[model samples]
Target: MTLKNFKVLGILLLLLAVFAVGGKKVSAAVEDRDVQYTIGVVVYNQNSPEMNMFMNYYREYIQQGFPVKFYFSGSINSAEDEINFIRAMKLQGVSGIISFYGQDIQKIVEACDEEEMYYVLGSGSISDEDYDKVKTSPYFLGSVGPDAKADYEAGYNMADYFADADTSSYIVLTGGSSAGNYMHLQRTIGVLEGLAEKEGLTYSEDVEKLASSEKTTVVDAGKDNVSITICPGYMTDPKGINNLKHAFVDRNYDAVLCTFNVDEIMKTITSKEEEQGSNIKVGAVDCFSMENHDEINDNDSFGNPKIDYIAGKYASMGGPAFAILYNAMSGHPEANTDDADSNTVRLYQGFWSASDKDTFNELYGYTQDIYENAYSCADLMKVIKAYSTDTTPDDLKALTEAYTVEDVQKRIEEN
Candidate 1:
């Protein structure tokens, strides 16, 4: 009896040891498998200041903690280019993609679904038709971008700033004309509306009316003493820039309103000021870098700051997009249950306007500090985890609504 009992006990102990070791090996294999996936980022322009700032925060605060690697496609200018970029990224074996360019949303979403890759929009909105078509795709994770109404409000506010400064005559720079440049068009329309309201001026023709015409430039607004010239084209258009310079030289307008390429136009204005000794005020929309901040705060010969107002995108646009893509890839997708289709579209409002130096300094200073200290890779992962299945679309919206410097600082502090 004693010998048999001892043999049974010895056999049981050996089996338990074998199972324990095998379980550990299986766990190790799963963890190793998690590290094999990759994410591809599609950016319109690699050299853009805003995109550069976004990538810096992405690498520091999001990419580091993730087990996946990152790949960046070259600049995409059109819808066809974006589709081609997605196909290439699929070929490279990316598990998911975050695209900054949102043109041809339906086609892009279809391509991602066909390739079995998760897709998230980094910025920009899709049309209603496109939304209806692709919103239910399992591969379409969703999108985050500047809200259209908020963008229009920013444009209105800036135009109001110029009018309050008593700007009577000005030239407006509208960036791009294609569907991809929809944001620019919204801002341009808002600027015209604001000017017409505050100055009692009226546009003979609107952007839509003028867009179809052969006229690229229009004297669209006029009152007894107030007038505005609108120029619609690409920011990097040499011909357009030259035409703007010629108009400025001839008329010596009171101000210049730029919807994009603020830095380039600022340089042009400074050159004109140096040559003709004219002090022209500027109101622009772009990311606020240290260099731009210095320019905004600098005084001309008459002791007046050259830049009156600036509306900027936050530095960490990539953070929320990464969270969306990561969540979908990790098998917990954020869905919009309120919509009839029960599909998700994560819209983030990201327009911060500062008219005074103190406001700009506070906003910029806190943002820099967060990037350097408070929000790390681990912190970003925690935020992404907050988007678990139990979380609602409102919850996801709250996470991305932290658009201001103060909002971001509070989130970091809470983390």
Candidate 2:
């Protein structure tokens, strides 16, 4: 053989050795791809029961399949805090984020966009103006939350429940300041509208004025025999509990309506009723727990429920939010569809309600069949996988539409 032929064979041999060594590393990287992708979760309060439930479910059921590590932000309150947390996550090699609360959404979106990290809004929503600003941003993976109108409707439903219970005289307690949380404001408006629509009910002109102001107001609903008083204020404030106790518990209102912080109100009313033998029925929104359910469903010594009705509690938004984030990170974003605009916002309806022990058990009792079948990780993963397939927004919406125990039962049976 010629010297040139011998050199050519040596070059080929060198190239073959290189491929053998490099191919193993490349294959190993492909197999471990999920390990490199970290997801940051910006939870409002990591210790909250809702957040606990979400994390527990995600780690136990979802993480095994997805194989991604999660970094949690500590109790974020402000937009600046959230942005700093996001930047820190980005620096730490986080590829995607799911934010449970962001008061300053525009800045958060901008920061995520600058970092080229995917962001999914979980359990909260951005304002229309902020959404419009970030609608076109590739980093904004979209939002998953309860419909804003549903908040108003939740208030309306609570009022209607009270009206149906023959509650002629009652008081209303709001959760937070109107300027701080628009959802609370919308719900407060809904409650007023519902009360105004009830037959044989008349509220003071100041009740109508609640649409403009967040101050607590006493609106008289009934005349002589039936009287209703509506008071609105932030439940988190130190003065809020005192005011609520004075207006509802001390004054012995027949019933109480609370749009936010239902747990605090419920506990206060329960304590007051236990001490004073008051039988004030309670209606509230966003208070769904085993204890809250028992309080609402169990009868007192006199055989009447301490609390009456609750709406919008069983709505677990974290599942959908996680699905959105996972899809975006996996390169199968639901927003990529022709029918879904990149800026499209997904809204889930509130459907859970408990009027009696049977219904309460069916909804909140851990041993119940509905509870047994409630939203498994596999079930949620189905929705996540659908984003890349033929699934439409309507199909996606259907997955979250049935939030009540009965509705969930029917959905499970149908499927």
Candidate 3:
């Protein structure tokens, strides 16, 4: 009687174990283990606050479900290095990538095509030529950044504001080695054009032609009743900085127009002011740093500090990048492309000067907060969930439905 009972119990236990294992297998099947996708972010450097923020946002959103890893080149200085790094990263086990450097974009695109992976540019707009090349490729998503020409125009607006005040003859300090040269030149052209329309202004016809030439050169784009001294300051070169500072003193320029790192520019301006007492007005594109405020020598052409007049930046960039990435990954196929020309990305157009602590803090606060939260993987996923179905550039705009610079600004204002 005891043996029979033991045998029956064993059989029942075996059957129960079998059922449990089968149930586990069924659950695993639903979860889809075979599809372990990953995103590889190829950035120039991890140390820069901007890069850190971009990666953080990507990682934050990706960690929720998608596997994301970072592949960064220490501090790439040339196009070749960037290309190699991207090529190597493509070989890694990643389904997609978001590349940051501009110099090696073509190479990166080619590599991505070879690897059969999806990609997008995180910052810096692409050229029409590049756009034409990737127009039909599924592997090439699109770029998420301000139009370089537009940024230049915004910067030129600062210059125009200064020129209107009769403060002519300026020096321009543009950022990003060769890549940055084009935008800075474009803004310079805009400044020249704006100046030409004003009374007593003279412009050089060579300005447009010079700006467009392969060799980066300085030229007056238009004739104005005023004289504008143009000096080219390379953003990354210390020699270029010193030369620009010297040009400011030598020419007694009315203003200093900068389109790159505000901190570095401030240092150049401060050194000149302290050493030579040059009263050059400082005008620029994008937000100014705290250091710039402490060191500003004069009110901008607009009566506010030049840095304070940054229009539609914080939300324009961070907000859209998050929106686009989300749409792309979540399945809105077209979220990455900016074909609409509607500034769906929030751009802040305001300025800060040393005289107004409130204004300075307000703009800085907004920009910083965006850097902190906007491009995260979660927000990105939200956009993707809504827009991932888009299969064309026209469809991408639909994914930007949830956010606006004003939305981001509102959050900043409330906080």
Q: On residues 107-170, what C-alpha lDDT tens digit does candidate 1 reach at each position?
A: 8888777778888887666766777888888888777778678667777888899999978877
Instruction: Write one digit per residue (lDDT tens) for candidate 3, span 1-415.
Output: 4673455455434433543654411122113344344455556655454555455444433343443343334455676655554444444444566666756466766766666766766666777786776656656666666666566566557656766665655555544323445656666666555655653455445655433343323445354434455555554566566657556556455566665545456556655555654455665554333344343434533354534333323322444443454455555553445544321222222222222445655544544443333233333444454524434444334433323445545543444
Candidates 1 and 3 compared: the better one by lDDT is 1
Q: Rank the candidates by lDDT, best first.
A: 1, 2, 3
Q: In candidate 2, which residue ranges exceed 4 Å CA deviation?
A: 1-37, 206-208, 211-214, 248-250, 274-276, 294-303, 334-336, 339-344, 365-372, 386-394, 402-407
Which 10-residue window in model 1 sums to the lowest lDDT? 22-31
CA-lDDT, candidates in order: 0.67, 0.64, 0.50
Write down the RMSD of all candidates, one decimal each.
Answer: 13.1, 12.0, 14.0
lDDT of 2 by residue, 1-415 (tens): 6674465455434433543654411122224566746777777765454555455445544455556666666667788768767766665567888887867777888888887888888666667788788887778876776667878898888888888887777677766634567787778778878877875566566543654355555555556766555465666566666667666544566677877646655567777667667577877776455456557666766678776777754424466667667667777766333435573455565636666666666666421222344554555666665434655545556665555566666656655
* lDDT of the structure predicted as candidate 3: 0.50
TM-score of each: 0.81, 0.80, 0.66
Off by over 4 Å in 3: 1-38, 45-71, 90-92, 164-166, 174-180, 209-227, 287-312, 322-357, 370-381, 386-415
